[model samples]
Target: MDLLTARIDLDAIAHNTRVLKQRAGDARLMCVVKADAYNHGAQRVVPVMDASGADAFGVATLAEGASISELTAKPVAAWLWVPGQEIPPGVELGVPTLDHLSWLIDARVNAPLHIKVDTGMHRSGLRESDWEAAFRMAARAGLEVKGLMSHLAVADDPANPYTDAQADAFRRAVALARQVGLEVPVNHLANSPALLSRPDLAFDQVRAGVGLYGLEPIAGGGSDLRPAMSWVARVLAVKPLSVGEAVSYGLTWAAPDNGFVAVVTAGYADGVARSWQGCLDVAIGAHRYPQVGRVCMDQFIVWLGDNDAGVAIGDEAVIFGAGGVGATELADRVGTINYEIVCAPTGRTVRTYTGGTGA
Candidate 1:
């Protein structure tokens, strides 16, 4: 039996995909499976998402795009790539810079691509000053310009005016691209937060990333999305601790009273951030226990106050998930985000799937 495991509910993924698809309305739904579906095992979840309602798939790298390209016949587009990388066959590309567009033209690469315009994100994308020039260049090279794409600078906050500003800028880019003789037909700019909040910004397609995995990007937006991942560890041992006795490395914490502590089989090496020590509340059976002391390389201690729930050595301890604290709650406690929470369970952690029928 694996000591640490990430229980992935495939049904939750399907439900989230369908919900996003419905939210997209007339627009297409592009499921972002980059970072291995945000470290949720894209190989397993991509098929579920495609079977549910994914119109396309997006990834950060060509390799990532290539990896999941065969999972679904739907088009896979990768946005983050260097100039010299070999373009994988059957995967679409997102031209982020004028230099990348020029490289593709010079190399005579014949692949469908989306022009990533810098719509105020100012991260990676062709600048507005070069939009017409780049569009003309792509048109002259006879490059198949699939559409335009942009990233939102601040869409998580519905109250943030930057999202609307970015939307307007993206719209202008599309118009300029068309004016410069590039069709730029299927343009998109909205991410998870924007897709959840602003349907008007969905343009031709909404790239649903975290929401596909059931994470509510907008704080307290309260969608019916179900969280899909659960990080769990096995209880290794239960030891009694005296009031003044300390535990683990640095001896940072001591038993407040004469109670028992359960040693859980997960630690920093397993993606449990050392900084998360003292902020985690592990759930075992029906009771919650406080994670005390310093986190170790392979394990940590959870104070099971009198062992009230009878947590045994082999009992399952939920670090975060359906039964324990939600990923968002744990993120708030650890000063991180739900995305990182789901991506945590690594080193020696086994993954298992459940409920994929979307029932």
Candidate 2:
């Protein structure tokens, strides 16, 4: 058995895709599979999404787009790339700036392009001042302008007014693109959070990212989405700790009494962040144990508290997943988001898939 594993449920992915597609209504569902499907392994999840209801795929880099272009016949659009990078064939491009547009035009890139406008995020995409100019330039260059796309800054908070402001800006960009002779068909602006909360902003397509992974983007918003990934480790060893005796580096935590502690296989190097020390609760069978002391590079100690459940070596210890704390709850404990929690399993963490056959 693998010492550490990120168990991915492909059926959950398919279920989430179908749910998002149904929620999208008339708008097309563009499943965002960037960062290897948020570290869920795009190579596998993409097919599940495609088989379910994903109308298209979206990635952050050209390489990522190219990697999964053949996975589905649906359009694959990559939005994050530098100007001089070689554009991959068979993949759509999101033009984030005038310079990127100019580069594409100069190179005569034949890929379908989505003009990324800065509605509110202000991280990437073309500024409002350059929208008209860029639109006209693409029109003049006879580029295949697929549509307009933008990012929502505060879509996670449904009550945030900035989402409304950004939606208005996105509408203006789409209108201006059409005014400048670009058909601007299939424009999209709503991300997972917006797509879940604001159907009004789902203009032409909805890019569902984290939601496709069964994570609710809105805080305190419960949905039918089931989490797909589980970070689990094996109990390497269980030993007794005397009172006043400590465990792990710095001996930051000691046994509250004469209780037992279990050595878990996961550590910081296995994507269990060092900062997660003292905050994580590992679940073994029916019992929950508090992780104590400094997190090591290859292992950590979880106080089993008298080994009531008799957690033994090789027993599966769920760091976060179905039997343990949920990703959202773990994120709340670690001062992060569920997105990062799902994406954290790396290094020695091996990925194992389950429920992919549609059973």
Candidate 3:
């Protein structure tokens, strides 16, 4: 085992996917595999995701789609963030926001795709009026409307009315498509949060991204999902510090009393963000350790106790895992999303994949 390595629980991936599969039912669960399966190693996780019952995979770029396509026989939908006049050859396309009909016409040789509707997210997808038009245009262009979908702008917010509104808009759009005689086979809308919290939105299919990894989007709670990634680094060096001695760069953290500071063998260069600052926490056995001072490019110090508890050099330090310390919580500490946290593992860390509980 390397000093710094990311332990990916392959079985947790399967478990989460099974939960998602149950929620999604016969509609098929589309596991969003963009950004290297949220940095859990798409190459490593796709096969397990396939075995866990993911009917299809969704990617942000054509390259990502191709990369995932090689791993599974299931259909790969390439979701394009930016519109181009032509679709890439040999890959199925997923348009983020269905804008123009001509774009689909230009990609005549590729497979069909699902349309992204900006129900209330205001990020992508076709407008309410354009929804029906886009579907008709896609069919006219010989593009099969594999799915009609929209995104929940605030599915994580239980009190937010936007989720309900998005659902209404999505249903309206689907009705309009059916009225126009378009074969809208699958109608999906909702991400991890929606899939977990708003089960009713699991229409014909639901895109499970973070939830498939067992992390709830909302801070407080949600459905049963197991986090599939665990980050661990070994304590490299331990040093005694006098009271009032500041640590790391910027002199941000000062020891109030005599204590020990242990330098961990990982840092921003390893994808542990410098912004983690005073926010992140690491663990040894059952004790919690605070990250002291500013996180450097390749190193960060943790405030071990003055009493030399049980942590020692070469002792494994768990950044997050099990009972609460998870990728989702790590992201929350720095005010980011779960996807960022999962993918934050620097390339330097050896990725060891295993199948079991407690990823």
Worst 10 residues of 3 by lDDT: 81-90
lDDT of 2 by residue, 262-324 (tens): 999988888888999878999999989999999999999899877777789899999999999
TM-score of each: 0.98, 0.98, 0.91
TM-score of 1: 0.98
Where model 1 places Cα greater than 4 Å from the true spot, the runs are: 357-359
Scored by lDDT, model 1 comes in at 0.91
Q: Tens digit of lDDT per residue, candidate 3, span 146-249?
A: 77777787788878987888888888888888787777787789788877677788888888898777677776865677788888888898889999999888
lDDT of 1 by residue, 119-223 (tens): 998899988999989999988888999999999988999999988888889889998889988887799999999988998999999999999888889899588
Q: Which stretch of 10 consecutive residues in model 1 shows the poorest summed lDDT?
A: 350-359
Clashing pairs in 1: none
Residue 357 CA displacement from its true place in model 3, Å: 14
Pairs with backbone N, CA or C atoms under 3 Å apart (clashes), candidate 3: 78-94, 97-125, 214-225, 214-226, 321-325
Off by over 4 Å in 2: none
